[model samples]
Target: MAVSLTGTRISVVALPWFVLVTTGSATRTGLVAFCEMAPYVVVKAFTGPLVDRIGPRAVSWTTDLASATAAAAVPLLHVLDLLTFPLLLVLVAVIGAARGPGDLAKEVMVPEAAEHGRVPLERATGLSGVVERLASTVGLAAGGALVTLLGPLTGLAVNAGCFALGSVLVGLALPRGTGRAAEDPAAAPAERSGYWRRFGEGLAFLRGDPLLLTVIVMLGVTNFLDAAFASVLVPVWARESGHGPTAIGLAGSVMGAAAVGGSLIAAAVAHRLRRRLVVLAGFLLVGAPRFLILAADAPLGAVLAVFAVGGFGAGFVNPVLGAVLVERVPRRMLGRVNALGDSLSWAGIPLGGLVAGAAVAAAGLVPILLACGTAYFLATNLAGLRPEWREMDRTRGRDAVKRRAPA
Candidate 1:
């Protein structure tokens, strides 16, 4: 997860900048983002059953290898003078397609890893958050420097190398049978069933849970806003404000570093706190403010401060969210349910960059940033008021139960 996600974070920084610099069009930059994430959302949504039946271990490494090939081809072709916009889109789409299943495979293994260690779900997921934040911090900082120094192609080359390394680690480094298919009675029968039937079962499970459904809808909206922020708003802000890519990297790394601290704290004690309050407070801190700050043309220090505070708040969110989902879903159906939920939360990602780019072109960057901030505030607040969210605190896995030490 660390190796692969770090590579992705670098791409997140490099890819948008590459298109923006090369094409000089926000809409085209967004189009490139759309091509990648659209396939990510669609393929991830449908590949859940395969992850379950085929085993996450096999699915992860194989798809990652595919992603490595596609990612490597971008720079390879670009260097050979054969790269074009259409071809770029095609390669990114391939990367996205492979990444979807590969990511899902890695995610579904978290709970089992926690079980083996007898660690609480919150702590386990919090540690996972720490890894993610650490990766982002390192990747973004490095990517920004590499892109600034050598060019975006250098960053792209690094991304390909990371993907290749990720495949090797998953395929040959992990212990045998680490993420093998579940051995549930349901698992055996379900393995024999048609793909659609398995997928339908997952959908049905997800649809029946009001809390999960509500979480999905809220996150879908927030993720869209986030996508807009990361892919377009920040890049445009950097270009217009004269901060450039280095500032973007610096702000992101500060935030991510702070988030690592937050996640560590959450891993240590978040399970003892009221999950609902933590989530609500985290939402308040994470959203709206950064957008508003950038819109106000805040100084670099001010921008970085807001981002750091928000990043710290952001750290508490995913552990609680991950714990909640895994606590409710049976181990047998975990992969599919997680896949569906994640894909739904990410569904609006492709459209986010697309819409933001067009909106920036039509109106301006500040207006879109303000609008995204306002939307984020409203979505988080309204979602908090939903009765279904109370359920977030209701479920707890056996592993999450703390045992008293003998005197």
Candidate 2:
């Protein structure tokens, strides 16, 4: 999982620079990003039931192999001077489409893995977050250096290699029956259901749960904002500030390193913390400030400090959310529900780069940063005040009691 994610992060770190340098157009860069993520969300949304029906393990390995092929083709074509802008978009889109299911399949495996390993769900998810942060730190650092020194294509090639390795691991390393659905009498009825029926079941579950709905909505907005920051805003800052790709690597590495520390701490103690407080504080620290700080043209030291602190705060969020999700949803419905929930939360991401690019082209970087920061602040803070948010904390207590109750 870490290897696969690292590959993805490397591409993510390098792709914007690749497009920006190749085309010398921010809009084109945004368009390329949009091409990739739009299909990813859409394909993942529809593939959830398929993952459940066929089993996540098979889906995971297959899609990783597909992703590896598509990612590898980009550099191979570029080397032959056969890669046009349109061709590049198409290849990226393929990678995104394959990645969507691959990512979802892996996520579905986590709860089962946690159970098999006898770890708490929160701790397992926290460890997952740590893996992601560590990957991001290493991948982004490597990507920045590769792009700055060797060029972006090297990063893409490494991404392909990682995907290949990930496919092999998933196919060979996991215990047999690891990702198979658990034996439950109720699961027979679900297995008999058609794809659309299963999808509807997942949607109905989400519609009835106000807390889950709220989390999805809040995350959708925040993810959109984050997408913009990663794809357009940060790269633009690096370019305009004369900090170059190395500086981008440094900033991201610092943030990711701090996030790793935070995730480790959360893995150890998050179960004892108030979910609402942790989530709200995490959002408060994670959102807006980095954008605002960058827009203000603060000293590099101050900017790095804000990013590190924000990243630390950001680390607490996913573990709490993941545990709550596992508690609320049944194992049989995990693939579908997680698919629907994640798809909804990520829905806004497709447009994030496109909008940021256009906005920056017209209104300039500082304005876009300031505006996005404000939107992020309102989305996180104002939304937290919603009555449904009380459900977050309540669910944790109820789950604890359920765990402690006599069998």
Query: Clashing residue pairs in candidate 1, if any?
Result: none
TM-score of every model?
0.96, 0.96
lDDT of 2 by residue, 287-381 (tens): 99999999999888999999999999989999999999987887777788999999999998989999999889999999999999999999998
Q: Which stretches of model 1 miss by more than 4 angstroms?
A: 186-191, 397-407
Query: What C-alpha lDDT do the candidate models reach, one value each?
Result: 0.90, 0.89
Span of ten consecutive residues with least summed lDDT in model 1:
398-407
Q: What is the lDDT of residue 385 in candidate 2?
A: 91
